[model samples]
Target: MQEFFMDYGLWLLVGLLVIIALVFLLSGRRKAEQPIEPAVSAEAAPPPAPVPFVDPIIAAPVAAASVVAEPVVVEPVAPAEPVVEPVVEAPEPAPAAPAPAPVEPAPAPVAVVPAVAVVADGEDDLLRLKGVGPKLKALLIDLGITRYAQIAAWNDADIATIDAKLGSFKGRPVRDQWVDQAKYLAAGDIAGFEAKYGKV
Candidate 1:
């Protein structure tokens, strides 16, 4: 330690001397800084060279953008319930009205009433002829004759047999008025025969 002190003592003295000279020089330079003249005044610092104002050139497209909106797609929804409707049927039209009943016309008036011929019950019409009696009347009716005109048409031989069979018609007038009346009725002269025989 004694050796290091002895060896640096001279160098320390020199550094101190140099430090004192630098202090003096710095003081002189600070005094000289006031000697430099300001020709105009404090405002003479040329207003920081006016920043050359240049407007930005931004280019934009002439046509406007086509702001097309996308179409909205809605998903189809399934039905949640089943619906049933009642059936309606049209009614049948009323039937056509029935036609009125037709009126029946009155029957035509009768002009004349005809007279009907009525033979007496059990009185033999064949008995009015000659040789015809109860027995002959029965036989004549059996032979399909119940009237005097039918008996009068019988020939004389037929009358004779029937008379002989009856045993007593001996004087028969079969060829007289009976035959004449029969001929008249056969000739469609019933009115004349009825007039002569008193309306049988």
Candidate 2:
């Protein structure tokens, strides 16, 4: 009995130590799982009455500016008198002279002449005539003489008139013997024309 009590007492002591350790660990777990209540202050002072937030940038209140008014006295002004200027009389202008009568232009002197008869056949190629070029042909056509017969039959007065009318070609008729060449051409005398002048 004594030996059994000694050996089993040591085992009971170790078992009791294990049970106490388990009880302490479970109690700590339970305490950690439970929700905790907030602690209350003794005199909360109503949260310090929520101190109004003031901006550091705002300036402190100052006394309002004072405005002083003074009385204004206006004096009455006197009325000014009007000044009169002397009037000058201008002399009347003399009557204007009557406009002179307009002078009439003199009547132009006109000469009567026979009208040029237009031939039924068109103008001939006077360029084929000796000393006759495009320019001379145009001048002859303007002078109403486009045919060889017209130039061949020109009288002294007609020649004089044509010679007078010729501006830059004044001496061409007499110098080039246009009448003789024209007469040969009018007669269709190619041989005579070639003999008198160069090749037709």
Candidate 3:
């Protein structure tokens, strides 16, 4: 530090004195450059610029960003919850009037037995009839219905008896018209049987 001051101290002091003198001269010239107010006019005219220190570029967005703003945080509020109602079961209907005393029901009538000739006690080819396969023929044989006359004599009672024993083939006797088919077959009416049932 002592060496720096010794080398440049005098030169620095001379430069400072020159700068101060130049500033003094410039200030005096600036004061002289202003026009003298006329004594004739009572009012003073306004200068073109009132504030020379403030620059037009100072109004830019870069100058406005000098101060940092702190953001305000807010907690969200929740909406009110909806209310739920309880469920109830419906009641049974009310009864009022009494029903009429039930009548003594008569016995159901049985189907009339056809007057077919009682055939000899020999097993006929039950399979020759429509819908009577070997399994049914065996079932019929087991039910003591080996002859065509046996099937031809079937009234409601006989049909009910056989239907009770037929298992899966129960309703077949009535639905297939086995009694009617057997009547034609028992009468030895080939033309009638073939015409009624398809080519028995």
Candidate 4:
């Protein structure tokens, strides 16, 4: 049913509208050209002439002829046939259908990258993070990770991505609490650093 409607919906709608319009047009003309008020009986006795409604619209020529005008006899055609005025009526409008709602597409996913900060001295000292030594510092620098703030900002995804590249350093960030140390180092909070993880 759905497939049939999908293929022929437009044509069916058009055909229905055409049929409706034709009906209205034919009805209008039929009403306009109705048969005169059921033809008056020809052999029956005729009604009296000079009726007010029939007199004015149909004119009083019969009354005038019946009056003392000329001596000529004007046969009474008074009720020969009934008078009819066809009425034309306006076509009623069809109801309109509501439109369908619009659809919005979903947004695509974006990759999350950790931010790296550079200072006037060059870059933050990754060594300050207790677990990151000179070799790890060099490796971090090579991997474009030069800021303590960057390490502090490592989410699970960032940690996973960097760990995948770190090889031997995998899981080191979590094991040594690098993010906690980096937070203190990034903020230059020496007192806080010593309070938590000993001297800087």
Per TM-score, the best of the predicted structures is 4
Question: lDDT tens digits, residues 1-200, model 4?
Answer: 99999889989999999999999999999999986686668797777797455656456777767778558798876655766778777787777676767767765434445655656788886777888889888988888888888888888877877777778888898889988898888888989999999887
In order, candidate lDDTs are 0.58, 0.78, 0.80, 0.81
Point out where model 2 deviates above 4 Å.
Answer: 1-119
**Which ten residues in a row are the worst by lDDT in model 1?**
109-118
Backbone clash pairs for candidate 1 read none
- Residue-level lDDT tens digits of model 2 in 26-92: 9999999999977879965565556788765453332222444678888888888777677777888
What's model 1's TM-score?
A: 0.26
Evaluate model 2: give its TM-score.
0.41
Q: What is candidate 3's lDDT per residue for 1-200, written digit by digit as tens?
A: 99899779988999999999999999999999999976755576764776557665966667678768889898888977878666676776677678988998887655333333446654678898888889999977766677787788777887886787788887998889999998998899989999989886
Residue 137, candidate 2: alpha-carbon lDDT: 83
lDDT per residue for candidate 1 within 1-200, as digits (tens), equals 88887889878999999999999999999998887665788766665666765444422232223555689999999888877778787898899899889989976543221222246763335654434468756754654555544544666555555444443544454534556665655466668767776553
**lDDT at 140 for candidate 2?**
75
The lowest-lDDT stretch of 10 consecutive residues in candidate 2 is 59-68
| Candidate 4 error regions (>4 Å) | 1-113
